[model samples]
Target: MASATFPLLPSAGRRAGLILARRTEPHACRLSPRFSTTPRPPSVPPDVAGRRAFDLRDERGEDNSRAQSMGTLLSHAGLMPHRDGNEPLSPPIELATTYERPPDGNYLLEDGRGGGRVYSRTNNNTREALERAVAEMEVWNPTRRRPKRRVGEDRLSDGSTTPPMADSDTALPPPPALPVCASFSSGMAATSAVLLSLNAPVRVVLPDDIYHGIPTALHSVFRRHGVKWTAVDMTDTDGVKEALSLSVAEVEGTDGDVVLWLETPSNPLCKVTDIRALCELADQVRCGGGSDVDGGGGGSCGVNITTVVDSTWAPPPITQPLLLGADAVLHSATKYLGGHSDVLMGMVSASSATSSGRRLGAALREVQSAAGAVPSPFDAWLVLRGLRTLDVRIRRQCSNASALAEFLSSHPGAGRVHYPGLRSHPGREIAEGQMSGGLYGGMLSFEV
Candidate 1:
């Protein structure tokens, strides 16, 4: 299938721009819902401003009845019914660059309520539909399923009050809130937004085996602007801790920040980093304590640090870094989420539970809107179409890659095959715990 083929590009060029340069003018298109066979109710009322409505509940309001399989969820992510009761199962693509304004020339009313439509650069119907679907898929919490609860017992056992239950007859726990997702013109655009959003001087720690373009950008673009970076072997937890300690010490007196940028199952080498361990280390750093560099007692540094995971190679159904306590998760939609080599887009998913996370999310959105690095309506629609079949495509790719890895490992001419599924691989134990659905991933590298 076209979606299974991963294209190769020049390493020296800007990857995001190169992928986008291949895009031609989009043609007028509308996809029918023949792909989604499951039947659903006619219309779900839209949520109020700043509220999320992606939770899938049934007529009985049971939690287990929600879509438990990846295939089922992917088939139904962005489709919504119209008020006329004959809406299309597929989401519509609106090509208008701008929206009509109200007669009073005010976008917001006295109550701060307004219509959904706005300028395309800030928000659009198609882009929002895609965002909703991606957010739902990325942040699905399986632990929310619980044993049945009796009536009138929804309140906390400790006497703390709780929000009213959706159903008075049954005391059901509230569904998990969705994470925030911001789409950009390209993967690098999203990456740059996150790095540029840091208001203070930062020391970015990176894996020595990560994608070369990132380090290249850090040196060529961000380095001149006062941001510093260091490369270390992320597999060595001790080395990583030492690097963080030195990083904080190097900029101890200034209002400098530290960031751990991780790419697990790293490019080419396929070295896996322990995300949980790194997150714990970041937490310790944020609490104003620094690890002793020369095996001495720890001291306070008053520095802040956060962990960001680039999980493009291990998209949904394979790994979820956020659940393991990563502050943010980024992806190159052009590679996996799009499934096919069509759309040039990127996405960042992060929780709003912490003040730092919320501020970073806002900064990313501000950069996206003010800099006009938003995806086009047609490109967003193409990505949405690709997402409907991501699960099936990725599964087949994984199977093929695993079989090839086994074959290459036994070959005398094939020097070494780097794949986490292989028992001989150093990161196999960590991969066994982090990956899901009995698959390592579709990507693998070998020395011929």
Candidate 2:
């Protein structure tokens, strides 16, 4: 479990590089369907442009009935642009800090994938690809496996990655909209973007025991900017409801934002917050259904409540907060997503499930560029590499953590072992309900 320290030259371009240090732990750590156990079709020769040498199909020329696993998604993420045999298998690092404008003077990008990249600080292909990969994986459902790609199926056929509309009445409800993602220089930057993106006069509800950095940011930095926050026991549904109610009541008539910041399988303590329950409560307050908090009057349209979950401890295929009704989800890619301790990056994915979520996503994109806290193209590319193996690494980590937790719980010297997988753990049931495949996570803690 050695740690690596590397100079991270951000988009800001500093002569003295900012060092990003990461501990590449076994606990913290994908492949394509083409290499699956299922039989594969014979490979075809590459075309002139060197693309689509072979189709991803079985011997019968039938698409695999299995839904594309998370592992495959991670391994193949950010590889769309390279699907052609002509391009490099790995994502290319676009080193240019700026792109030339078209001769016609129009800055719009026709690809729609890389929106008008006039400057690297605001936009870069490397960073945007990672954002799209994260957003797409965040919404993927493992339980309801869709058959592998139909012959002519394209995720962006509708000009977006939304799942195509179902043809029959028996079709499942349309999945939640794919979230919008923004990458940052660090986890704190991502958190700050969400807090800073809010209109002034904001109230942020935080878990009493959570990531120290977030509370630090709010108290020391954001507080001076008219942002208010209260720490509540997130597991206590009533207490959380009260805190949101009171915070909203204080800003009853004003135009502002209330953010419920959650960290699940929370840092050190392994506290699992009921994301869906709290999100429902926040919605009730946002819609002014909490009559006691605001004199039973209609909810203030001026006051907005947003639920953001910092799932740094729980990466995808482990837990998806946005799918659980969160307005957004944040991850410190430097930790688990990067997996190799070589990249320093953060991600903020705003859910498109709600109108408020949509607005938050738009605002966050603006803050990312305006604040200029963008990660370097190299750092972003590193994360893309890390993502390729995330599925296998984390599953193994979770398996290891489960064993460690069991041993600790029975040890004579150990006082307490905290892990969601354990039956004795307070949040075990909730974790089982939310976490995919009953995989609690890699984080565990104990005191002797």
Candidate 3:
């Protein structure tokens, strides 16, 4: 369909199709056997790569089947999308009403032996396909820090003999497979889901200059649920220590749920946090004596803190936070994943944070279903539709921003330029340590 002319190819199948049409009176033609192109309902036609495929259908086939074809495509076409993949240039799939589930089919609203879907609200093919893809792609491996060399269990403090620190696991964990992905209505929806899941005090160690949404999300959502949050500045290592120490003392007997959220390349200002260092601090905070609770090394005394890093600023091939020891990676897929600034969405990826991030996924699923935060297939498709360009967009944004930053840095009216792409950025070293792609970013904010 991408090609306007389905001119019967030299292939025997095309020839046969045409021959059959000609042999039988156009009005008397019968339908052919059903054939599905992909295993998952989302798999699009081989020609459904680039453009929207709803309008385009095989001109040779019985047009009556277009409805079912549309359903299958709406649910699965967005899965393995190809940038250069051909498309028939069709209208999008928009099923106004729910369809009955086949005997073997699973329906979103259907609750049965397999929890089949019975209604569009309960579940839809599009949502299922998207959820599966998003879930699979969200899986990531969280990094763990190595323990500092210790002489013995007891330190020089009080001159007491210390025991040798134990090695938990020198090697890091492999990334986990993401099975479920949550698409939130707003940033608050995403944050609120994580905070309220735990029915206890929740500490949010945040940077001083944090995004307003984060604070509002934590306060309105968590506070209302009776959870507490504590903020932390990444600038001073000792500040992190002090905050954690005091926080621990406060949570004495009541196991408070402490979640430390970080925004690297600090929003609006391109400030970067050393994920490696943050993870280390989180470990030290979680482990009583700076030991490894995440298993990188034990006996050093560090608690296992649920360190969540917002990776929306940089997605895969650019930066992967779980690789740097972050317990979980959260994304405001809106900026980058959503690309055009058209769609608003958020995502949470798991690493070592909460049981391979599965529990978090499960909890999010509940919250999403309960709160109705899951994005529609169209929205998910739209968001993912932009993801294919994430790499290019970030690269170009980084280059362009760097150029602008340099201009601003030298401009007479400008006081300063804080762009991280510039080698002068203090956190550039840390940025280079964890970021997977371009040296710069697609966004930069400054004043005259």
Best-performing candidate as measured by TM-score: 2
- Once superposed on the true structure, which residue ranges of model 2 sit more than 4 Å away at CA? 1-65, 82-87, 109-115, 143-175, 290-302
> What's the true lDDT of residue 243 in model 2?
97
TM-score per candidate, in order? 0.76, 0.79, 0.65
Q: Which ten residues in a row have the lowest lDDT in candidate 1?
A: 47-56
Give each model's whole-structure lDDT: 0.74, 0.80, 0.58
| Candidate with more favorable, higher lDDT: 2 or 3 | 2
Taking the tens digit of each residue's C-alpha lDDT, what string does model 1 give over 5-28? 234445643343223222243432
Model 1 score (lDDT):
0.74
Per-residue CA lDDT of candidate 2, range 22-76, in tens? 5575232112233245877775443411222223334456534455689988988
Looking at candidate 2, the ten consecutive residues that score lowest on lDDT are: 291-300
Q: Is candidate 1 or candidate 2 better by lDDT?
A: 2
Evaluate residue 117 in candidate 1 and report its C-alpha lDDT on the 0 to 100 scale: 56
Query: Which is the leading candidate under lDDT?
Result: 2
The TM-score-based order of candidates, best leading, equals 2, 1, 3
